[model samples]
Target chain A: MTAPAPPSVAGARSLVEPVLRDAVARLDPLTARVAGYHLGWSDPYGRPATPGGKALRPALAILSARAAGADVGSCLPAAAAVELVHAFSLLHDDIMDGDRVRRHRPSAWTVFGRSAAMLAGDALLVLAGELLLEQGTRGGVWAARGLAAATQRLIAGQASDLEFEGRPEVSLEECRRMSADKTGSLLACSCSIGAMVAEGPAHLVAALAAFGAQAGLAFQLADDLLGIWGAPEVTGKPVLADLRARKKSLPVVAAITSGTTAGERLAKLLAQPDPLSEPELAEAARLVEEAGGRAWAEAEAEHRLDAAERQLAALDLPRGVREEFGEIIRFIASRDH
Target chain B: MTAPAPPSVAGARSLVEPVLRDAVARLDPLTARVAGYHLGWSDPYGRPATPGGKALRPALAILSARAAGADVGSCLPAAAAVELVHAFSLLHDDIMDGDRVRRHRPSAWTVFGRSAAMLAGDALLVLAGELLLEQGTRGGVWAARGLAAATQRLIAGQASDLEFEGRPEVSLEECRRMSADKTGSLLACSCSIGAMVAEGPAHLVAALAAFGAQAGLAFQLADDLLGIWGAPEVTGKPVLADLRARKKSLPVVAAITSGTTAGERLAKLLAQPDPLSEPELAEAARLVEEAGGRAWAEAEAEHRLDAAERQLAALDLPRGVREEFGEIIRFIASRDH
Candidate 1:
């Protein structure tokens, strides 16, 4: 049976953004400015910023709290804390990945200078803990602990990702573990923190985290698809941007290990120090598909999405809350950009 | 009055290093390896590391807790947390400053690669919070909050320092403010967290933080002195390394704005885009001293130390605690490295 239309993402974000903005505001003036600009609360010139970013992590956090039977009001801090952490990672990830653009604008490091952006990211991470400290309930300590653990794993994942980038010997297994740590850990935190804030039963909390982990894997696979095939206008990044950097994205790694002629060609092209030309980059993308990387990623995404769906039955969520979460999972799995 | 031959710093460090090591061990294996190397807990080849840093921050934390009448054993986590934050900053600061050497060894970023070092720093910052969360008392939450606040200020301080580095117009006031935030805030946190963990009275805690702030300023001023005048063998850095970078340290900034002929000469020497030659760098250092920068820094340091001393009467510390702490303060003010 078809599920009813899910709750509005915009609605969920609007509910969570104020709290998130308030937390960001608590930074020292200089950091607040950098974080504000990064969060799209202001432009580089200090004028009010136009709305930007999907507010997806906070939406998940709020939805997770609802699924665990909490009202929006009580769960706001958990949602905001997770969003702050998401922004923190984004700031550092841009620096670590050396990407110059994000969300159709110059990335924070490119505009504010790398050191300032890094410091801003550092401030946001601490701010997340500070905001969580104010929660003052028993769950506050547990929630903060969970966030800390997730952040550590996220850092570990990114470290592994960087380590793999310089090595051609990375296996598919290693790549998947990196993806799970880098992406899944924080998403799981978003869920786990929500449940902790709601005082959800331990089993329910574990189930929600499991759902988030699988959903995150699906999200990364979808992201891998977009990195290759999506339009720049939609993705807000140049087409083949990841390939231009010779990033060992999942599909690319899959193709490299496929033991086929096209795979060998892709591997050789990636080893050069010079920037890949447009035609060469395009051909590289095609070779990945032909090497069965695209098909493998698609199947994996579906498999993860299905696995995520099964975890929902383990939660005693209300009907509407369950439907809304299902819609988000579907969105993550199938989004084009 | 002469501070009665301050307690041995090595003695203090020996008390705190094990706790710090235990916390460092909590990181995931890969990050632990990177952090271990940075901390001198392990070699690059994963062999046992030689004795590393001086454990200064943790010593201060533990001493502050003692100054608040808490036993060293009970305050270990708070001390460890401060040390973690200190290491976190060092890791990121190395990246931001682009320095290749730290503690007389290749910096983590240079040896492990920048992204890995950055991720390791991120992991350390989160680990600081996690260790504090395990404090498990009411003071645990407040102590974590204190650490978070200090961390945010430190980031702001670093951000401003980065901004000042690229501009020629930094005022002594701005430089001093940056020093307070970057250095003083964390020192203050060491004291404040110690007191909070002991559940010290609010006024006493504030007084300790105030003392730490003044002492921190003195510490930075002493550091500035060493940056220019300390022997390479003692400081573990090349002679005139700060001058080579044309850093806007208090002395350097004071020299530039001193309105003397020497100050003008130093400014012109600094304005060149190319690196200064050995003769030019030495001349610049002499010019700074000639412009009265050294004297000003020395006097400022004494003034700050005196101010820090006055805050101690407010503490009502145990009999030996105040004397031991006074010795530590003296040590911070006068140490060559």
Candidate 2:
């Protein structure tokens, strides 16, 4: 249905998995167990489980390195580092958000205690920096710097998101900035880090970073849509989960600021003190669609995707590499989970 | 008292505070405000406050660099990074431990909220790595790697500390190992990272690290003693704070494992469910002393100080530098708070 995914997706996972596991193994036993569980590498009892996560960030890193004309293995540390940062952010975010589910399973804080999950997140973050520094090259240092900057932005984005929850008035522009920082920073870093690690030309690295930034925004729009309307089975989340949480996601923000009767109704519903009932959530969803929020998000995502594609097209990469990047971008735009 | 505080302590603080402030300024405004408050540079309202914290780790870093024959200013980044890491750990630990007060004021989480404090801590951690990597030197990479390893051990130590809270029978050796990981690892890194960043010889770095490890254990022993009997005004903590939390600090663990009648009584008293009353806490402190926990801890601190001194004496350094290191070690061993 989605062109079967680019080969680089699976290839990146295979190459980066061992490195990730090894880095996690370096944590203390209890932390390793918690981290391993959160990463979907094992069950609560430490037995193997189906590996979880899309490994999308690492795939982007690997593809960026490939575009730089480096061997696939050249950017392994960078790839692993990006994924580790992503994992770290998710673990902490779940605890802060009080979300009990992640990747279709009980979140780490729900499985392990909050303190343990928090420590595991800290361990992963430290391990990411260690992994990159262990490369012992200037490129490694450069990549580590990039990753750290991105992580800071990601944290700021999350902070803003939490702040938005308590505020009644969140402009769509503010929501978009939050999405860019929360998701786009790491994605852009992931795209450029591999090329940076491979000593790619400056122009190529910048182009890839720009492309990833646009794609990341597109990816966030799709995710926000899923948060509201995605099936529970496909998205590994409850129906209308965002609306239930009163999350000021892009569509919700767009609707709240739409200046229409349906938008006004939706805002009033979200402003209520009690949690929304199932029927109310359904009505809220309908109102968001009726207010043109859903259509706006869809159009914005498409626009971003086109911009991402143009950036990739202008790059002087091999055809296969370009096609691989294109396929991953499209996959992200259409992913159900 | 205790040879009048070492000039290097004040000197290090002066040298590193600006750099530390600069690094924290890079964070988003809200996180930066939280971090600033936690660092004692500002009040909850963002107004300037009297500076807090002893800046001992940064002093160690600066002194270690001096010991390596590098200019005192050369290790500012390493010193600032170590201090940032320490602040990061304290911020998160306060949240995890539910501590309401820190450095004689409300903890960051209490002043702001848990989520904001956590994000601030996360921001600081990322900024620490970024500072080191920004140096763009091979030594910077090496120091970042060392800091990362120490951070992992520190997290492991914290995990063990939390785990020990529920377990009734924690062996003395296990508790000691936990202390080494929790406190010794970072202290050791702080002592050695300066030299590592200055490209000092391996032997010098190793000696500095060993000295720091020994001093760190001694420092923890002293801190555990203070937790039981130190003046609340001086310690900026409630009387018998650790006991109130049922923390398995070294002294408490020693008393519990002492195999004396007093130790048995202390254990029974601790095993009760509700919060310990003030009188009960006082009684428990007396029992710990009667059970020889206090004496044993004092002697162990002395023993560790001797080892630390021997390591420093063997190093090829100027007399003034040696005196400075000696003064700090002595201060650590004798400090009441």
Candidate 3:
């Protein structure tokens, strides 16, 4: 790939802020406060912070469009729309999975309670639809359709995620299937939709979609790796948190299939009711590696990354623009945390 | 006073079924099946049922439009929309309220599990939004606004409802406020949106909204009456289900306020731990009557109907149309079960 364009990180931040700002202003104080808390605009005590999350999904939509030859101004609505969907899912997922901490603070549900959390999530989701309907793009129809489809996939993926509880029979393929639906589907929505809004050539847009899809899979694989092996400081949670929760992440699924002693031990250890001690977490992580799960997951992540690279290479994006998104995809896959 | 027109129950039934049928068909087979079950489309085993919910909401919507002098043909989208919202609320309510039966069968969550139930509800709500968005009427925006507002109220009302458990001091006024948000708001949506789709004059539409709002309050009062004393053969649930559940419905609230012997007994029974037997249920019902709770509730229902009737009388609706809806409101208010 040609030398990377200057990162759209700053451009996207500038572009997306006001859309959200206007949205916040339009809300009544209570819902606005609830929503503000969700955007990490406030602490559990309702105090403001430095703001939060990388705004990755929205950035991807905006960056990909410029990379694919569209103006950033026109893609703002799609960017905001994707961010709302992402936030909505995060809120509900936190509630259902009983995840108490988010961004090193109490999760929205844990603070506001499940009922309010669920309603807040609904409000965000509906806001996405409203954003799409209010879009300036000629493809507002398609934008609405894409956002809705992504929503369905997100829920379906979450359904599978919940189904994976305590069920050791999860196949790697199944994890991949769930990941694609949950993560990759929305990422694909961003890329495909970004290009569509840019009026990027159809074939190029398809390639961008493929790139986003693979990149999303790679991103998730990397996240699973972090969950299992990355340092607690880097990952913002305990090591082997997925194993403790009995989440059927890629590493865990791969380990089960290997049937090594550590793998067998992991399956048995997870069934116990005692809370996972530090040793248990370390032991689980070691078992996954000894069973070749870590290597396998790494290889899978790389393979997806390679596919994303190939799609990018196929696309005739401007050198600077292409390099910017390429760096983003690589960062998503290769970040230590 | 002008004579009320008799509702063509059969005609309304025929008009709404096909609309619901086609709209629900909007989902994929898997999700649609879940939705169909939620709508009383199938047995738990996925087998089809002969028919479904009374389509009462949709019928009211279409009839309200006709009563307001709009072509019924044009209101189909909003009609399907409000019904879907109703169905969405029901699906979620069953899960939250722990109700196991719907329309004489196992609730969708009991049959399909909570996640599927949630998906089904979400699908219906999303489809409702899509239908409203694509409807292309001058009233389309109004329908969307009313629906979004009503749904928010409905959800808030449910939140208030679940909050009432173990709170011994819930007064009659609070119960009325909660029921208005829960039921009255939606009924107002049905008729208001119907008139909106027909582009009826604002004053007349407001009048119809007033009528529907009152009707819904009266309807829910009748429901509270049936909840305690109505027979299972007619009411479709075991008698006194609400009493056993310790539901703080209107009569209980009224009794507490009336401060009679029966009211005192009700207060004591409500504070107890054990299940109320049939005799106990009868005693509680008797106490509510003795304390004038029943009469008060009945009078309240009549007062609402009178308000509804006054609103209808002010509307220059075709005499036949106005009378038909008036009969519906009366039937709703005074139903035996």
Question: Which candidate has the highest lDDT of all?
Answer: 2
Q: If scored against the real structure, what TM-score would every candidate get?
A: 0.93, 0.97, 0.80
Q: Please list the residue runs of candidate 2 whose C-alpha ends up more than 4 Å from where it truly belongs after superposition.
A: A1-5, B1-4
Local lDDT at A335 for model 3? 55
Order of candidates by TM-score, top first? 2, 1, 3
Ranking by DockQ: 2, 1, 3
For model 3, residues B203-306, the per-residue Cα lDDT tens digits are: 87777778889999999898898888777766667778778788888877898778677788789977878877778877887888888988888899989998
Best by DockQ: 2
Which CAPRI quality tier does the interface of model 3 achieve?
Answer: incorrect
Query: What TM-score does candidate 1 get on C-alpha atoms?
Result: 0.93
Query: What is each candidate's DockQ, to 2 decimals?
Result: 0.73, 0.82, 0.22
What Cα-based lDDT does every candidate model obtain? 0.83, 0.90, 0.76
Error of 1 at B126 (Å): 0.5
Q: What share of the true interface contacts does each candidate keep?
A: 0.84, 0.77, 0.08
- What local lDDT does model 3 show for residue A194? 73
- Model 2 vs. true fold: TM: 0.97
lDDT score for residue A299 of model 2 = 97
lDDT by residue (tens digit), candidate 3, A1-337: 1233235655676679779767655543445566788787777666777775666677788866777677777888889888888887888788677788777667887777666676666666767766665654446555666677777776777767866774658877888888998899888887777766666677876777788899999988988888877666667676667877778888888887786887788778777788888888778878888888899999999999888888887766765766777777777777552
